[model samples]
Structure formats: structure tokens, C-alpha cells
Target: MEETRRPRLAWKIFKLFLVVLLVAFIAAAGGVAYVWNELQPPHKGEMVSFTIPAGTSSRDIADTLETKGIVKNGSFFWLYLKYKGEGARFQAGEYEMTPGMTLNEVIGKLNRGETVKEETIHFTVPEGYTLEQVAKKLEEQNAVSATAFLQLADKPPTALSEVLAGPLPTDNQVRHKLEGYLFPETYEMKKGSTAEDIMERMAEELKNKLSAIPDFDSRLKARGLTLHELLTVASLVEKESAVKEESPMIAGVIYNRLKAKMRLEIDATVQYALPEYKERLFEADLKTESPYNTYLHDGLPPGPIANPGLDSIEAALSPKDSKYLFYVTKKDGSRTHLFAETYEQHLKNIEESKKTAK
Candidate 1:
């Protein structure tokens, strides 16, 4: 009886051992499959930048990877991603993946945000942007407060004094604070920068761009432009001419008008005074007074009409030579104008314009 029991027990132990071996072999096979697939291409290596559309399922993404050759086999990626508990972690967006990247590395990028560090803080301050114009541009981005930008322009930083040798003139009641020195261009800013920082960067860029202006200081002196006049003329140029090539002629016009002691009757100056350049002006709007009236006050208005561009600056330095002491826009709105040195000729142009309008 004892011998029979021993034999039976031994058989039972043998069966248990076989079961253990079977489990071990299955696990080994799985490991081998996983390793074997890793050596192959994702599919065939077609994807450099992969876009996973929104709402893609695990199987769908794996299939896409397989079709693109980004994975040698989709089954392995599926199993691997699932085992790592990353099935739902694959973000939907543009992704760049490579064969050199391990399954773990690719998953990590997706989980962290399929998005590399990026910024959207890009906008421009046009060559002729006034403090108000700048404020409106910034307001569109929400990077800084427009009100704050405008207020700062009214009281430019003392630190800026080192840069703006000829800022806007303060004596003129018509002129506001630092309008012209803002220097217009596109600026990149942090998503959440302070208004002061925005102002400083703009000021710094302005100084740099303007510094390259040859004999800018001497030109400022000759024009009696207390930094203020430069800004004013710059503003005028910015407002008057869209073509950089025409800036010199525009500057010459400003110079000629000043030379003749003529009223620089620029509509832009009127617009500046009204702070509503966007609206169409009636004759009454032109007649209003707030210091920026170039028609009434004469002598270059109170301040810059807009933020002047580099062309305006260059134009101010090198005005075009002409006998034109007066210019009036033609009725065609084709930029055709009448240039007159005599009052009778100028009056004749005005009468012609009225007849055309009638």
C-alpha cells in the first residue's frame, strides 16, 4: 500500500511541474515576440511628422502607424502601449516620431503634449503707429493693456532719456508725450508680459533702429525738431505715404510747407487731434481745436500725427527738390495732385476741384 501511494504522489508532482513549464514557455514566447517586433520598422518608416486626428481610437492610431511604416507591426505598438497603461494617453495632434525613439520615448512625447514649446505673441507696430495706434494693436493680442501702453507713452521712462536724445517737444500744448520715438515694427513678447516690459522693449528697438540713422542728431537740430518735431514729421510721413519710395517726397513737402510758413494742412494732424482717424472727416471736424490743428496753429502742428516709419525719417533727412509750395488732392482719388507755387494757381486748382466735385 505504501509503495503504491509514493508512486501516485510522484506522478502528481510531475504533472504540477509540467504545468509550471507550460506557463513559463508561454511567457518566454510573448517576450520573444515583443523583442522580435522591436527590431522591425514601425511599419516601413514613412512618417516623419504624423498627424493623429482627434477621436482616434487605440486600434485606429496603431493601424495608422502601421500604414505609415512608422511601426514594423501595429500589434506590438498596441500591446506595448496598452501594457504601459498609455492607451488613452496618446494625444491627437501633429507628432514627429522616429525609429531611433523607443516605444517609451514616443509615448512620453505624446503624453507630455505632442506639442513642443511654442509661442503666439507676435504682432506689429506699423511704421506710423501713434501711441493710440500702438495701444490698439497690442489690445488685439491681449499681451499687454492698451490703456497702460497709452499712459506710458504719455510719460516715457526716464531710462529712455539715454536713448531718445530728441524726444517730442514738451513746450507745445498741442503735442503729447513721446509719440514719435516708439519706432514701429513687429515685436515678439512673452504671453504674459507686463506693460512696462512691453514699453521697454519697444523703446529699446526704437533706439537701435534709429541709431543707425546717419547724422540723425544733426538733422534733428537743423529742423528745430526737439525730438518732438522728428516724431511729428515722422508721424506725418507715416500717415501720408504708404510707399517707402515716396517718403522723401512727402518729407520735402513738409519741409517746403514749413519753409513757406504755410499751414501744413495735413488731414492726419486733424485726425490726431480728434483721435478718430478711422472716421471720415467733415469740414467742421477739420475746424476743431485741441492743439493738433496744423491748419490753425501752423508750424508742424503740436506733435507727431502718427508713429513715423524709417522712410519718413529718411525723407525728413533728404527732401525732394521741387518748386511746389502748395499741393491739393485731385478729385479722382488717384493720388494725382496739383502742385502750385503761386496763390492764383493754387486757387485755380481749388476751383477745379470744386467744379469736379459738383
Candidate 2:
């Protein structure tokens, strides 16, 4: 009986020893892994640029950094962040990383939001540019693709709905939602901004500037015109009058023609209807059947012919009181025009303009 008890005790001791060995081995392995993850660099002396967009998760950030070869292991990085109680503290932006950084070092940089500087570009949208022309201008600056910009202009972004109407017409027939809404001005934007982003910026600017005008909405209501109609007329005014001071006079001429129930006979509308704008319109251009052709269609064109400046918009809102119904650009070096009420006076001005041209 003693001999059997001694052997059983020895077997129990052996079993305890094996358990201790297993525990020690696991602990040692865990310690080694922790040290390796903390001290080991993912790569040696290689720099990479990584972008962390807004609202990205820790796991997704880890995965992105890992995929970019900026970090060795996403799982380990995630675990480290969780252990450090920094799982939710990562900042969003473009970050520059070097492979020589350890796990702790990478976390420190991301936590501090030490991101790379953003690349920005500058561009100017001149007044009187048509939607197509604006798109072409942005494309020339490498800010956006002309095709993408034009498509977006026709449909526009939803964010602009508060300031402007939908694609469907309200009181006036319009071609595109952003024809006159893309307020022309100099602008700066990040290099990778989408065309939609750029359009939204311009639309926001238009909304802000329009809001600053005293009684802008009340004035539009008094004119018996919607904002769309006002902009349409303003665009025509912009294209017709090169001299800033003549903007109000040009607006007056347009209003007088509309009230007289006569064709506008404005050459700028013919230019808008044609495939390409020209310095001078031929007789055939006047016969174009498009709704934008004021010679063929009465009143304001279906939509804005081009983007108008603030001066043109203000002129449309408060046109000069006048009986003048005609205007002819002088043939002399002056870009100003001659305005008259009767056909006889208009013809006389034309004759004088012709003589001046010679």
C-alpha cells in the first residue's frame, strides 16, 4: 500500500510540473511577441504618403496603413491601439509616414495629427463665361474634367437645392441648373477636390453674395420676374454691354423690348444659340430656331446665356428708367453702344457706326 501511494504522489507532482512548463512557455512567447511588435520596424528608410479620410475607423486606418506598406501588421497595430486606449483618437488627413518608424512611433504621429501638407490649386472664373466655357476653363487649370463639370452643371449637386431650384423649371425655361449659379470669381481648392466639390463651393459663394444684397428677393418680386429670369436677363446684359457703366442701360433696353411685345433683336442671343460664339453674327445666325435666339423668340432667352457678374445682376434688378429700345455697338475703338427709341434714330446710329468703322 505505501509503495502504491508513493508512485501516485510522484505522478501527481509530474503532472503539476508539466502544467508549470506550459504556462511559462506561453508567457515567454507572449512577451516576445509584444517586444517584437513594439520595437521592430515595418520597413527600412522608405517614405510613403497616406490619406485618412474623415470618419474612418481604427481598423480601417490600420488596414490602409498596412496596405500602403507603412506598417508591418494591421492586426498588431489595432491591438496596440486598443491596449493604449487610443482606438478612437486617430486624426483624419493626409499623413506622411516612414517605414523606419516603430509601432509606437507611428501611433504617436497619427494621434498628434501630424499630417502632410495638402496640395492646393488656384483658378479664376471670369464673368460672362457660359457653362461650357467655365467647364473648359477649369479643365485647362487641371481642376476638373470639362465633360464631368458640364454634366454636373446640368444636374448640379443636391446641396445647392436650398439656394437654387431643381433641374425642373419654375417660372422660366432654363437649360442647366448651374448656368448662372456658378458665380464667376477667383478660387482656391485642394488639388484632389472633385468637380462636385468645386461646384458646391462656387454655389455657396453665390448664395452668400446674393444674400448680402439688400432686398434682393423683394426686388426680384417687384420686377415681375423669378430669380431665374433675372439671371437670364443679367447674363444677356453682361454679354451685350462690355462697359460696366452701360450694364443698367442695357438692362433697360431689354425690359423696354419685352414690354413693347417686340423681338429683342439682340445679337448676343444669336451668338448663344449658335454652336460657337462669334464676334459678329451673320444673317443666317439670326434665323436659328432655338429658344435662346431672342431674334426668333420674344422676351428673355430660355436660360442664362452666360454667367453674369454682380454688377450685371444688380442692373437686372434695378434697370435704368428709359424709353430707349435699341442699342448698336459703336464701330469705333470704343466698346460702348448707341441707344435710341425710334427706328429712324436706330437706323441713323447704325449708319453712323458704319461710317465710323470705315
| CA RMSD per model (angstroms) | 11.5, 7.8
Model 2 shows how many backbone clashes? Answer: 0
Error of 1 at 338 (Å): 3.3
Estimate the overall C-alpha local distance difference test score of candidate 2. 0.84
lDDT of each: 0.73, 0.84
Alpha carbon lDDT of residue 202, candidate 2?
81
Quality of model 1 by C-alpha lDDT: 0.73
Worst 10 residues of 1 by lDDT: 38-47
Model 2: pairs clashing at backbone N, Cα or C within 3 Å: none
- TM-score between candidate 1 and the true structure: 0.61
